[model samples]
Target: MKIEILLDIKNRLGEGPLWDAESERLYWIDSLGCVAYRCTHDGREIRAWDLPDAIGSMAIRKDGNGAVVALRRGFHFLDFRTGDVDLIVDPEPDKPNNRLNDGKVDRRGRFIAGSMDTSEEGKNSGLYRLDPDLTLHKLDDGIIVSNGPCWSPDSKTFYFTDSWSGEIWAYDYDLETGNVSNRRTFTRLDTSTGGAADGSTVDAEGFVWNAQVYDGKLIRYAPDGTVDRVINMPVKKITSVMFGGPNLDVLYVTSMAIRHLPRFPHDPVERGALFAVRDLGVRGVPESRFGA
Candidate 1:
């Protein structure tokens, strides 16, 4: 288990690391920077496109040239070639203060993303599902700050995080119909340790790995929601994680650069860098593509 900087490029609000297995490339977003980026497995041949607005997250399209992205305004299609953005839908037309946040593609090809209150203190957002048919459905609501949307290896259990509540919730998932129910607390972060759950990913063995923001910890949880291990990150504002590289054995991490936040300082030159944890002795399932 060795961790090293993959890219030293500082991202202001880096989040949503995704692996495109087919292309052997890595994609990620600098949320506040309003940019989408892609690079080779070894961090070479990088390319980027300026987005229309702050991008929350994105999924590789089934056809593979572009992506389906959740921007601040709503869901949109991003053409990596021409830098074009086409609107998909804005589920929350009434909640002007909320923005789409962390998201991922389900095993069944539906994109599940949650919104967060920009104020960071209002439960005015909801979780949504976007099917391949281009229809949107609301799954759950009353969320303040949503993060960490991922499912178990079997795709029967869905895990999500409301950072403000400090709790990671699990729910029953129907892969066939894209329905979720029976929500319950899976694990709660001890914020007294100075962190909240940021982003998460499930391994091929069914363990959940979460990036703890402000506390600089990467926590691995067993299927039963017990802490299996913890790795202290070099930066305090670790935002997201994903398993990339050709074999999906590398854990790629994203972090934040803004220093004057609530509790973070202006130190740690690597605060906004991208990282790769190698030789973890674990592999990850291929991320499903949108509309696949």
Candidate 2:
């Protein structure tokens, strides 16, 4: 694929990229930076804000003027016009060691995200679902590090990954009632070929494109969990990726820089940088809104 540096922010933990079809802009977060940013696809007209906590993932509001944010504390409303934040709830207020991670808006508009223990003890992290009505439900737990919650093109299948483990799970998703069942191991990585799976996205053709945490490669998996394609990256700490661009044909990837500073001091081209790959010619559906 044709890859090029799109944004050179070089964040410590860059993840959770989303495309706003209404505003025609792309949004992402720098976890360690505790910041969320919005910028054009061409890497111009940038605007950013520092949140009170590390922002893991965010979904654009249906109203088009705000975002549903998965902050360290919990879910909140971030108003872009006024810089206002309204707390919805802190699902695990007592668990100071855990924080929200990768998140997505379901087909029905509920926000689904997962949390992981910062201590890496892997004791009490879990997957959570927040209904548009503001009710929080624990879907699963005992996770080490949670990442990636993308749906199939038809929105009938849900895919998730626990970065600590080298496996991805799939579920039969019910869009009407916001229910998931039939959990099965969709695929397990060898870890020798790639590191853990960090983030992923589904395409128009139902293929799952996942990023390798420390292996510097992005892989495309067919619906049956067979590997189809691989795109090698220039950085080892690739965190997350999303399909953006006006036509959703450009694949935007986020990487980590601080962890690789000691190994790639001379990395002037692509270490921890936001990259764009445009040769695949695949398109993605618009990100679902925060609420119905």
Candidate 3:
């Protein structure tokens, strides 16, 4: 199926794009602009919320009510109806150079996110999990550009990426204990290519769909570590991807137009647009909003 350009956000740095099944809306973040956007299927109405800091990613609650957001300072609960934000946790209070990057909620409704250096040049970041009880645990360390915290459909395997390392790693996940082990290289990007792996999501078949930043493409990988398919995009930097729509057939991808090259020309229109491709038939899990 062909991918369609749903929204032209002209975002300077578009990062996370998620689909809320209950509301039938698409939510995404513009990391540099510190803005969150919501769009419907018909594309008639668009709503946006301004964040105090860069918002890396967000997930809707299990009850289909609100959302939980990963911010530069920490995580927070966002009331969709009123736009009220409440702090959840601050992972790196001492390191002002780092901030939350990409994140997703697991099958158990736990928010797992990672951190990255603000300059995008150091390995001082790590992956973290926020449990239901609000306790924060450091899952993995020594990550530079922390991306993808996606799990398999059965929740037995986890896939993560460290962009600077140009590699995507998979681990045997223990859902009961929230422990990850058996780390092994799943895929490696050719540095000669324009980009590396960014955010990713798993399909029902356990295949991983990863957004290749600076490459302007989304790659679908088979469990055996073979490149199954590549969906090309109009923009150069593809930050993230998620399955949305009621049937989960729509594949939504977020792209950024940042000038990663030392002497690259800028295209005003393609820099931060939200693009969508249809007929993939992949549905995504909802974001978990906290409840009393």
Candidate 4:
């Protein structure tokens, strides 16, 4: 249960902490800064690429050339060597107000992501699946700020959150076809308790860990959607969570620091920094790569 700051880079909107096991490196993004970052597990050899638009999330490619990113414009191929971004498609071309947000690669190597309504009021966004063939399919619609896309250890259930709704939904996942069905409410946060849902990851033991943004709580849930444990963080704007490190035992967290909090002026200076939670007594499954 030891919490320590790994990097105090002061990211404006830090999200998407991804662990690359093949290279033993970490990847993340500063959404507001329009920058993607990479570093070692110990936070060294840091490199960054300036993207044209705000990036919500990214998945490493099997070929190791770069990543398939969910940028504000749409899905694009980000080349690590040349920094060239090639657009795939804009799933929400008609809804100019919505942008791609949280996403993850399923066990079958399909990139699943959802859009978010920038206004935070409309339910015009959609959940989409990008197949290995570079084809995108719409899975669900009417979401307002999609976040925390992940699945159960057995690949039978898919979990996703619409931050504005304060509830995380579970769907029947078909690994063979990459389709989702039978949507049901898995858990609902009494925002008074843990704040809204952000990013999430499933551990090796079939537990779900989620970061609650405003309240700064990292919640671990059993497979039945019951709260198993809760860890309070030092910062309020904890944006995302992942399991990294060589052993996949270290829990990495990202946070947001968009502006000075006039209300909580005494907030810790590490609010926007990256954090590592070690000695959790648990390990995590490796994240699947896109097109792998």
Q: Identify the candidate with maximal lDDT.
A: 1
TM-score (all chains, Cα) for each model: 0.98, 0.95, 0.92, 0.96
Q: Cα lDDT of all candidates, in order?
A: 0.91, 0.86, 0.80, 0.90
Residue 142 lDDT in model 4? 85
Q: Write the per-residue lDDT of candidate 4 for residues 150-245, one digit (tens) a residue.
A: 989899999999997888889999999999999999988878753789999999888999999888899999888899999999998898999999
Model 1, stretches more than 4 Å misplaced? none
Cα miss at 17, model 2 (Å)? 0.8
Candidate with best TM-score? 1
CA RMSD, predictions in order: 1.1, 2.2, 2.1, 1.8
* TM-score, predicted candidate 2 vs. hidden true structure: 0.95
Misplaced by over 4 Å in model 4 are 259-267
Q: Which lDDT value does model 4 have at 39?
A: 96
128-208, model 2: which lDDT tens digit per residue? 999988899888888878898999988899999888677999999988877788989989887975478988999889999
Residue range 1-292, candidate 1, lDDT tens digits: 9999999989999899999898889999999999999999889999998997888899999999899999988999998788899999998888889999999999878999999998788988999999999999999999998899999999999999988898899999999899999999998788897789999999999999999988889999998889999998899889999998999999999999996356565539997898999999999989999984
lDDT of 1: 0.91
Stretches of candidate 2 above 4 Å error?
Answer: 260-269
